[model samples]
Target: MADEKGENPVTVMVVDDHPMWRDGVSRDLEAAGFTVSATAEGVESARRRAAAVQPAVVLMDMNLPDGNGADATTAVLEVSPKSKVLVLSASAERDDVLDAVKAGASGYLVKSASVAELLEAVRATFDGQAVFTPGLAGLVLGEYRRMSTAPADDRAPELPRLTDRETEVLRLVAKGLSAKQIATRLSLSHRTVENHVQATLRKLQLANRVELTRYAIEQGLE
Candidate 1:
């Protein structure tokens, strides 16, 4: 399970009000070579246990008994900044998806996903990719693009000044280019492309590639 530092077999915490769902998710993750750090039924318990364990990923249900999962995501991240929250909810509502993203969730997956899909989403979220249920990624990105026309204050802050290279990388990212593709297009190494992306994320305080793409669109970089 765990390495010498007890960190191997990535740690996961399951937060859902339904006992059956929670237990099943935990079981699946454990079987997939993850350490089930903790399980909780609602926001407060999730927050407390998450702070204590600081799991690498959190599988959260949107409609918790005590509060919405978005709020719980915010609270949990406040305590465990490195933990990625992936919403596993029944709702695929646009507002729900947007809210989770704005609250800093790393991904959103509706309950209709197959076990394999869910597992893949968990891995993607842990790897800092922004996973979304089918059709939902376009919805979120479109909403951000629409918001580009709003008043300046209505949008997120302008990214801290980026170098010309960083800006170019960001534009490519917004255009849906992968790191490898961007590297080849720009005549840069893949590692260099990834470095620029991370720098952009840090400067803009964005969580993942999805948010970075949203920012690029909002800034008219795409």
Candidate 2:
């Protein structure tokens, strides 16, 4: 983890099949003060480079040479459980987004993302805040809401309900507050905010911060 002053550089790995996009993003991130630890063009290469670099975060393209980003995400998680994965892809189709989440991505962004937004996404992902393209956020949340309303008997009964406190935390999350910022606002410890976030995810049957952010936005938490 980097220092609280935001001057300490966070190590990052860039995974994309296109050399142009990969190199451009790497240069952008480097200019933003994040250390570019490694760059890879496919799932296999990503796995190997991730292992060698042990980056704090990874910016991955959805389509790769050897395998898709979803496959690479699973591999990277296996090798670096603590490293945050942010999917930077062009596809916003329901299946691709959901599959990437299932494979353990902390956030999702389309390739059209501006350099500023990409930098913000990386920081947000590291701080345990989920991110998604503004347009796709609704689609993802609507899908979840639709799925969340299916036959009661089809799913678990004790669908963990969010405590009021957790809902408050969710609101802050949707507003792009980092865990530390949320804690400060709530007058709680940072770890407490993180705990609420985890508990909220469990209750909502969501995968990570990205999903949580989408849901919160749909529910007008922001």
Candidate 3:
């Protein structure tokens, strides 16, 4: 079932301190047909295992035994830049969520999420979509808006210019519309909408929809 890129069911790593939670998540991923590459109980172990496994997605818990998951996320990305980290934590604190995002997490999900939601989030993360629990999406966008108001840094590189349609698509993306939804709204094919999204990501040099959403907010599109 592997694709051309060798990611068939999508490889995943589960990182959580709690043994039961870790096992449960790993089982769930396996049951959902994902390849559970590894499981770790702490940030340091997670970082090391992530480097070795290079899983497509790392389901990380923010509060780990050795260190914060956010720092581990950064470390993991350093070794496996293509891997996407999705924070699965009980805490919905704004600071925690923002910290993980700044550290390069692809999404954030509270532990209260249903099994279906978790499964969908893992797939979405693999597909480059930004998955956030309920109201947290707006919070993330608001944070970006606040950050954008600050004075520009001279050292910062200029953003690449996007086409009108790309910009429109980005705006809708920042508003949390999926490609299919955007396609329906814009009277375009779903594939075309996905193409536009990919184009926007390339032009913006962004990793995924989360970063794209941040860029849109920074550009005052939100």
Candidate 4:
């Protein structure tokens, strides 16, 4: 059932400066059927291991040695385009959250999340959706709305915008369907599903599937 819905186990990278936290995260994900492809502490190690493993998603900490997690997000994304970074921090500060998003994080989650919530977030991230914990989603959307209303600054032209088909694809994405699974459900080929995903990303100006998920939620697409 899970595989059919594209809920198959995902490959993940866990990055935290705390050893116990890392171990706990790894254990939780593993128990939930995901493979912990790699584990790293601090900035340099996270960057190096993320490049090496190229996992589908990265669980990152906001504070790290050598650099901030936001900084690490940029480096990891550069090396692994398929990977989405989700900030797991103790902070609920708007500055910290916005900083991580600006640095290319797909989502920001407070460390208070339950194992179930973490599992869902990781799966959602894998499925091309951003999965922020409860309160943070509003913060992100409010920021985007504010930015949209801001004076014409140097920001790039608005993204192309999602087509009707693309919107449907995104809805399915939120349901945790992989490209292949989504294709089967929609009676399209896997390549077509991939194309739709890529188009959605382009339209939303998201770096990866994780941000795409968040965008869908913010826009009430799903």
Give the winner by TM-score.
Answer: 3
Assess candidate 3 and give its TM-score to the true structure: 0.84
Give lDDT: candidate 4, residue 101.
76
lDDT of 4 at 180: 84
Clashing pairs in 4: 128-209, 129-213, 130-213, 130-214
> All predictions: root-mean-square deviation over Cα?
3.8, 4.6, 2.9, 5.9
Candidate 4: tens digits of C-alpha lDDT, residues 128-159:
55556666655655666666665678565665
Model 3 RMSD in Å is 2.9
- Candidate 3, residues 1-222: lDDT per residue as tens digits? 143376577899999999999999898889878999999888779878988999999999999878888988998899889998999999998888888988988889999999999998998888777788987867766776676677776334677888999988998897768988999999999999999999988887877787887566456575
Instruction: Estimate the TM-score of every prediction.
Output: 0.78, 0.77, 0.84, 0.69
Worst 10 residues of 4 by lDDT: 1-10
- After superposition, the stretches of candidate 3 with alpha carbons farther than 4 Å from their true spots are 1-7, 151-165, 191-195, 207-210, 217-221
> How far out, in Å, is residue 222 in model 3?
2.9
- Rank candidates, TM-score, best first: 3, 1, 2, 4
Q: Which ten residues in a row have the lowest lDDT in candidate 3?
A: 1-10
